[model samples]
Target: MVFGFLTSRRRAGLRAQPVPPEWRQIAERNLAIFRRLSPADQEELLQHVQVFVAEKHFEGCGGLELTDEIRITIAAQACLLLLHRETDYYPRLRSILVYPSGYTAHGEHHVEGGIWEEAAEDRLGHTGQRLRALVLAWDSAKHGALDPTDGENLVLHEFAHQLDFEDASTNGTPVLESHAEYLAWGRVMNEEFEALRSAEDAGEPTLIDQYGTENPAEFFAVVTEAFFERPHALRRRHPALYERLASFYRQDPMRFVPIEQERERL
Candidate 1:
């Protein structure tokens, strides 16, 4: 109890601190979505960013140097998930490891019965329930930040995994507020998951990424990317899925201008 109280106090203090000019500048320059947020949401995000930056450790891997720019940029995106919601700041996540670009991850894969093969795969980001860490490629992270409408975001994808991990399982469903909410989430998510899988099997174009068909967990993460980055398209194609995400996230991203339209204005 004492520890929890102290941690909350510390975070409250961090959130209350004034936003450093450099931090503000870094967020504005690197996070395009930050520019589109309402004033209230922007302030909420900055506060979350402050607490997240103070709590999470960031390390640059593969000979890259870590900077405030990188830290703030990543934190801004991760905290974007926390906006307008009660949050523990991705309670299970502790460290963020960033590489200069896509890095090779080596692991063992099951090739057949009782046999495993070692393999290396290039990845932009990764997170798992046991790891308590997020791995990201800085270049991809920057690109995702710069192009928030792209429907793919490294930080958001991995952090969605982090949220999935919060319930002690990496299932498509996070911790919903009630049993009724859980029922709704399961029904909608299962239907959408099956739809995506069927679409993939039939070779039809899909708005929710074919990768979501990998499993329920990846479906959650992929839809989260679509929820934030391609809200209108997701809503148009899958209203129930979009409504579930908006209810869970407590943010209706359709309020923001489409990036294409914003570019046309420029």
Candidate 2:
């Protein structure tokens, strides 16, 4: 219904139809994330991922080919969030603009001498700029995706921004159903946000990313990264925070991740 948003018809059209075994093979090969999902969840997600990839247009930003692997990897991660919600949850988002690797944004800044440097600003795509819902393949976007501990998974991080924007402000609160829930959400999230900010300000390392201390919105996005990538740790460190996120997401990834881990061990 909103401009720049895709219609349900368009989304229906993009639904992953019967794909050849090759595409599934490609998706499994590049998407460690796909393997993390349960079988039923995987099939459901695959359907959504198909439609998601079909509906959004992809352009090669850095001379890289928009291969099936790239599309699947991006779709797989994005669809991971939707595993617990409906496609309409992302109805506000239409296109997914991805980069081969990390990109930079240039801006102006002020100096102490009251002089402004025209090129004083240097920011990684993940670290700066909040526009143009970006899904970057960090490996290709910047230095490649091999480093799991770079404190940056651009795809996961920025898509979390898209989720944050659903509440209309990137201030960490997303669109919840009712006013009472909204009140509870504000109280819980603000408390958690304060804890993260205080921990970082005190120069103590916290399980959550320190960058989350940057602001409420950053707190939402960064904590979301912790949610998907490290659900158990989030639950262990902040049980209330984990519970609220599980409620909002409608999926107890803390439960799902462990089930997934157990399956793998077996």
Candidate 3:
């Protein structure tokens, strides 16, 4: 089949070329999230990153030009989500569009008196457009990768949206490994979604971003930011949600880090 041939060719590419020194240096310099992976995951992630960079197109917007730093940095952060999982290389994703900073998109929104109006919403990043393009703010993306514990990564957040959209819907649920897992996913996620909604309604603080309360779809994207960036804090705050994410991502990120970095040094 064509799929098998493409996959075989991809494997051949990864084997044919070791990650270039320059790309490796760039990845090492930028990926604090990379340190949060186990050694095996880290190595595998590098391979995936290489494939991703080669496969996806990177285009600049707002007069910002593309460079290796931009490509590798985005590729490194984006591919981390695919680590430890069999993936189709974000089949829906075709290209990345980078803006120098926040960009505006025209859309309808309710303003004064709850009247609908056309407005321009400035965003750090956006996805869900035709051609499966992801638009990111370069500075935001870099700064997010620089601070691993902030629990907000533009790249991770958008890529999470990509994963969720793979099902032809933007629901919070991703495809699980088994039917039972799907049932458990619905139960646990709905319970947590309700809790978050309650917290928001009561004007109480939530460990996850308030944006997550928007809907199940946004909840999945927002928690993905927490799951990878603030694993320890997420575990302390919402143990069940953290457990489900860890189970789904196959990563106990808190345990994978600092130790992995130390081992790399030894």
- Which one is best on TM-score? 1
Order candidates by lDDT, high to low: 1, 3, 2
For each candidate, C-alpha RMSD in Å? 2.9, 4.8, 4.6
Q: In model 2, which regions exceed 4 Å deviation?
A: 1-6, 89-95, 109-117, 120-152, 256-266
Cα lDDT, all candidates: 0.89, 0.64, 0.82
lDDT of 1 by residue, 1-266 (tens): 12488888998999999999898898889998899898888898999999999889999999999999999999999999999888888888899999999999999977889999999988999998999899999999999999878788888999999988888988888878889899999999999999999989999888887899989999999999988888877887799999999999999888874745422110
What's each prediction's TM-score? 0.95, 0.80, 0.90
The TM-score measured for candidate 3 stands at 0.90
Worst 10 residues of 2 by lDDT: 141-150
lDDT of 2 by residue, 9-58 (tens): 66655554675566677556665556656788778878787777766666
